[model samples]
Target: MRLSQFFLPTLKENPAEAQIASHRLMLRAGMIRQQSAGIYTWLPLGLRVLRKVEAIVREEQNRAGVVELLMPTIQSADLWRESGRYDDYGKEMLRITDRHERELLYGPTNEEMLTDIVRTFVKSYKQLPLNLYHIQWKFRDEVRPRFGVMRGREFLMKDAYSFDLDEASARVSYNKQFLAYLRTYARLGLKAIPMKADTGPIGGDLSHEFIILAETGESQVFCDKDWLDLDVLDKAPKSAEELQSFVDWATGFYAATEEKHDPNAVPIPADRLHSARGIEVGHIFYFGEKYSKPMNATITLADGSTTPMHMGSYGVGVSRLLGAIIEASHDEAGIIWPEAVAPYHVGIITMKAGDAASDAKAQEIYAALTAKGIDVLYDDRDERAGVKFADLDLIGLPWQIIIGPRGLEKGVVEVKNRRTGQRDELSVTDALARVGA
Candidate 1:
């Protein structure tokens, strides 16, 4: 994409509303614009990153054997009533009334709706162990929505509902999601630790919150230092017993949110302990019959007896991750996007857009990169070299190719690594191979 043609309205100065690095960089980089308190319109650059994050979530969910389905953002208030939670959900639930005076709501979560759907169609044990997932927008009217998309009232989410005939079978499904989340975060260049968590308002005994440690995070968390090195994917479990073994190992360490933390109950030595502020990026829960039983989502057992299906809920903060990632990855310069989720793999900055030789060389490299299936954002606008460089750093593409009259005269271009801030001059072919590779 050419910058001249692209609608990136990057700001030279930080906006007053931005309180943190992610918020400020997002605004200055022209990735998003706030329309209201805690609400934003993702611009071209931001939307690309958002879609990439959603795609990774979808891929991991599918890899874990979860089927994908779309659910409406607006749900029936009567659906919540079925589970006796409509009024209990409090002011955060955006209640509404249609012209017919029927109660409806912009769903904060989808447990009630999903359970209702399962009860309507799934009838027997043979249909057990089904997992349905969707990537969609959600809203929760926060009383004090702040910190940009980090705590937005409206955002995108990836939610998956799992149904199984019994507690044992349900665990197998839960374990699949556990491992899936590990792979998902790792792919996005985050080390999200799974810590035992309470099922606030959701009502489940078994739950885990995936947290990424960041100085700007809202929640204070305590965990073992070993978690930084431990990869959950390395300990993937295939059966319920194996799953329990892995869970036992994870819980053996000291890790909990403030609500669940016990200062003196930590099992690890003082040296091996660690504490930090963390952002909650994902959560998994096994709420045996919590939604299903209340909603009468029953299935016939092998012996012909009827019982409520055991269920679990898995959620990834699709939109919040953008903020969380920026919080964890950015430097003083700007966002240092992970390679997997970068809007473009490479950015081509032409030092002199009007110079015939420099312009031709940049266009040639851009074409070659695009032809090689690489996404390149070419700054073909007639802007100062310093301005282009700053924008390139702010947007944080993994690699950048700098084309100038001097470099073109030498039969080469300058290649720079955004994260390392390293520059090397190489022939156009060598530069393309290095960045495109």
Candidate 2:
């Protein structure tokens, strides 16, 4: 992508309404523009990052044996009524009415709808351990939607629904998602600790919320200090027993959101407890028959007896992760994107756009990187060198090649690592070889 032709409307100053680092940087970097309170339009650069996040979520979901499908944003009110939650869901549910006066709603979640679909088609235990998932947009009309996409009214989410014949089987599905979440966050360059959490409106007997530590988080978190050092992914548990053992080890540590915490309940000594603010990026629930019982979603057992299906729901805030990643990764200058989710892998900065040598060298480097299947952002704009450097740094690509007349005279170019702020002067061939571009 050429900066000169790209629709990246980066600003020199931050927007007045942005109150946090992620929000401010997103605005100044021209990644997104607010359309309304708690709502925004993701520009091209922002969409690239959002899509990358979605891809990771999808890959992990698939690895966990969750089948992907698309679900509609608007749902029939009858489904919610059958689940006995139409009125109970409260004001956050955006209720609507069609021209014919039939009630409708923009679904905040898909519990009732999934249950309805299962009840209509699934009839026997043979279809027992099915998991269906989708990546879609959701809306919850927050009373005060603030903090950019963190607390947005409209957002993208990856939601998975699991159906089992009984509670024991449902837990296996839950464990699968548990490991999947751990793997997902690890791939995205985050150490997400699974914390005991209140299920809230989801109404589940067992629930866990994945928390990523950040100073500018929305809620206070208390956890066993040991959690920071444990990598559940490293354990690589595959069998049911192994998976359960890993989950047990992870949850055995004392950890809870403020709402679920009790001072006397924690077994950890004060010296071992770590208290910090954290962002909730994903959540999972084993709601059993919360939706199935109310909606009569049932299946026949092996003995021919009929029973409501046991169900679990898992979710990752797809769009909200953009804010969470920025919160956990950015520095004073701009967002230092983790390599796994960076918008572009390599950047070619033309030090003097009008200079023939500099421009030609940048083009060569850009072509070399792109031909190697690396996403390269070419800064070919007719702008000052300082301005281009600042913009490139602000967007925070992982690798950069600085092509200038002076460096070309030395038979070398400058290569910089964005994260470490280290620069090396090397021959153009050496630089290309270092990056394998």
Candidate 3:
């Protein structure tokens, strides 16, 4: 993509309303724009990153044996009432009425809708152990929606529901999601610690929130220092018993959110304890029969008796992840995007766009990398070198190839690493091989 042809409306100054690093940088980088309070329109650059995040989430979910099926943003109010949670859900839920005066709502969550779907189609123990997932937009009427997409009223979410015939089998399904969340975060270049959590209105006895450490995080969290060295993807569980054991070992460390923290109850020694602020990017819950029982989502057992299916809910904050990533990975200049989620892998800055030599060299490098299946942002704008440098840093591509008139005359171009601020001058052929590699 060429910068001159791209619709990036980058601002030279920060927006006063942005309170955090991610919000300010996103605005200045022209990634997103506020459509209303707590709502945003994701610009082209932001959408590219978002879609990358979504793809990773989808791949991880599929690897965990969950099937995909999209659900509607608007759900019938009757489903909520049938689950005995209509009025109880409170003001956060946006209640609506169609022209026919039927009650409907923009779903804050899909527990009831999922239960209704399973009950209508699935029957008997043979259909048990099914896990279904979807990535969709959700809305909650937050009284005070601030901190940009971190706490937005409208956001994208990856939600999965698991159904099993009994509690024992349901646990195996729950464990799959538990491990999946950890692997997902790690793949996105995040170190996420799973901590015991309160289920809140979702109403589950067993719950875990996956938190990533960040100075600008909203929640205070405490954990064992060993978590810093722990590699969550070190081992993969292959059996039901192995899954249970892995989950037990993973949760064996002492970790809790501020609301659930109990200093005296911590099992780790004082020296091994580590406390820091964290942002929650994912959560998993095992609320057996919570919705199935109320909604009469029953299945026939092997003995021909009927019982409600044990169920669990797994969620990942798809849109909020951008804020969380920027919060955890940016410096004073701008966002330092992880390569896996970067909008583009490399950026080509043509120092003198109108210069014949400079333009030719930039196009050559850009075409070579693009042909190698790389996403390259070619800055062909007629702008100053300093301006181009600042924009490249602000956008945060992992690699940059700088083609200037002077360097072209020297038979080489400058290569830069955005995260390390490393720059080197090399032949054009060598530079392409390095960045493209």
Candidate 4:
């Protein structure tokens, strides 16, 4: 993408309403624009990152044996009523009425709708361990939505519903999603610690919230320091016992959100206890028959007895992750995106846009990287060098290949690492190689 042709309306100054680093940076970088109090219109640059995050979530869910299927945003009020949560869900639920005067709602979550789907079609234990997921937009009308997408009223989410014949089977589904969440965050360059958390309106006996540590995080969290170095993804657990063992090893360390924290319950030494503010990126719940039984989502056992299928719901805040990632990764300059989730792998900045040498070198580097399947943002605009550099840093591509007349005269280009702020002068061949590295 060339800055000259791209529709990036980057701001020179931060938006006054943005209270957090992520929100401010996002606005300044022209990644998103607020449509309302809690609603946003993702611009071109922002949509690229959002799509990358959604893809990672989808890949991880599929890797965990979860099938993908999209459901509607608007749901029949009858489903929530059957689940006995229509009124209990409170004001956050955006209740609406259709032209026919039938009550409906923009689903805050999909437990009731998912249960309705399963109940209508699934009839036997043979489809027992089925897990289905979808990446879609969701709305929860926050009383005072703030902090950009972090606390947005409308956002994208990846919610997976698991159906099992019994409690033991349901746990396996939960463990699968638990590991998937860990892998998902790791791929996105985040170290998410699984913390015991209240199920809240989801209503379950067991729940875990995957949180990423950040100074600007919304809530306080406590966990073992060792969690920062754990490698559960090196080799995935395959059996039920292995999965359970993985869960045991992961949860053995003390970890809890503010609402569930208990200093006295922690067995770890004070030195090993790492307390920090964290942002919730994902959540999982094993609610047994919480939705299934109430909605009569039943399956017939081999013995011919009908029983409510045990169910669990897993959620990843797809759009919210942009804010979380920025919170966890940005510096004073701008967002330093992880390689996997960066809008572009390399940015080609021509210090002198019209200069023969600099423009030629920038085009050469950009073409080379582009042909190699690297996403390169070429700043071929007739802007001052400092303005170009500032915009490049603000957008925060993983690598920046700087071309200047002087550098081209020296037969070299400067390659800079956005995250480390390290710059190196290298030949065109070497700069391209370094970016691949």
| CA RMSD of each candidate after superposition | 1.6, 1.4, 1.2, 1.2
Which candidate tops lDDT? 3
lDDT tens string, model 1, 226-264? 988787667767665677678677667678887778888
For each candidate, give its TM-score against the true structure.
0.96, 0.97, 0.98, 0.98
Error of 2 at 117 (Å): 0.7
- The C-alpha lDDT values of all candidates are 0.89, 0.90, 0.92, 0.91
TM-score-better candidate, 1 vs 4 = 4
Give me the displacement of residue 280 in model 4, in angstroms. Answer: 0.8
Q: Number of clashing residue pairs in every model?
A: 0, 0, 0, 0
The reply for model 3, stretches above 4 Å from the true place, is: 238-241
- Give the per-residue lDDT of model 4 (tens digit) for 58-177: 999998899999999999999999989998999999999999999999988999998988888999999778899999999999999999999999999999999998999899899989
By summed lDDT, which 10 consecutive residues of candidate 1 come out lowest?
232-241
Q: How do the residues 178-222 of candidate 2 rate in per-residue lDDT, one tens digit apiece?
A: 999999999999989898777898888999999999999989999
Model 1: runs farther than 4 Å from truth? 237-244, 258-260
Instruction: Determine the C-alpha RMSD for candidate 3 after optimal superposition of all C-alphas.
Output: 1.2
Give the per-residue lDDT digits (tens) of candidate 3, residues 1-437: 99899999888898999999999999899999999999999999999999999999999999999999999999999999998899999999999999999999999999999999999999989987899999999999999999999999999999999999889999889999998998899989999998888899898799999999999888899999997788768865767668888999999988888887898788999999999999999989999989999899999988989999999999998999999999999998888999999999999998875899888888888888889999999999888989999998998999999988888778999999999999999998899888864
- 346 Cα displacement, candidate 1 (Å): 0.6
What lDDT, from 0 to 1, does candidate 3 have? 0.92
